[model samples]
Target: MPTILCQLEAVLRFLSNDPGDPNMQACRDGLRQAIAALKRHIQAGSSR
Candidate 1:
């Protein structure tokens, strides 16, 4: 899981740093939501 998160974090960082296009706002929003959801899931798992 940690390894996966590390790799994923790199991608997330790239996405976050990107100056996204206005036309892709919906896709960016969806990615943000998905990242948040994954964070919540990770937090929940770690709390156990």
Candidate 2:
């Protein structure tokens, strides 16, 4: 199964075209933040 990080990455890539809608833009921004946070968590966990 794909990890949450992978799934979120896919979603972000799908939205890379910039749909020109304010709502979609905000959603994309949120996704980017989520992805970043998830990545940091994963990295921190892996160091243990």
Candidate 3:
């Protein structure tokens, strides 16, 4: 699986060039999920 930062970077690049594109929203949503998952993973690790 790709890292959250990589996913976010891809999404950012897509949006930067085509902010109004419909696929841009999809990419953004994917990035959001990736970031949320990464955060959860970090929090879980820190609590241990």
The runs of at least 3 residues in candidate 3 whose Cα sits more than 4 Å from the true structure, single-residue gaps closed, are 1-18
lDDT per residue as tens, model 3, 8-35: 7666666768668788688777877777
lDDT of 3: 0.73
Candidate lDDT (C-alpha), each: 0.70, 0.85, 0.73
Instruction: Indicate the TM-score of model 2.
Output: 0.81
Candidate with better TM-score, 1 vs 2: 2
- TM-scores for every predicted model: 0.59, 0.81, 0.63
Ranked by lDDT, the better of candidates 1 and 2 is 2
Stretches off by above 4 angstroms in model 1 are 1-22
lDDT of 1 at 27: 56
Best by TM-score: 2
Task: List the candidate 2 regions with Cα displacement exceeding 4 Å.
Answer: none
Candidate 2 weakest lDDT stretch, 10 residues: 1-10
List, residue by residue over 1-48, the lDDT tens digit for candidate 1: 567666766675666665666645655677677777888899999999
TM-score of candidate 1 versus the correct structure, residues matched by position? 0.59
Which lDDT value does model 3 have at 29?
A: 73
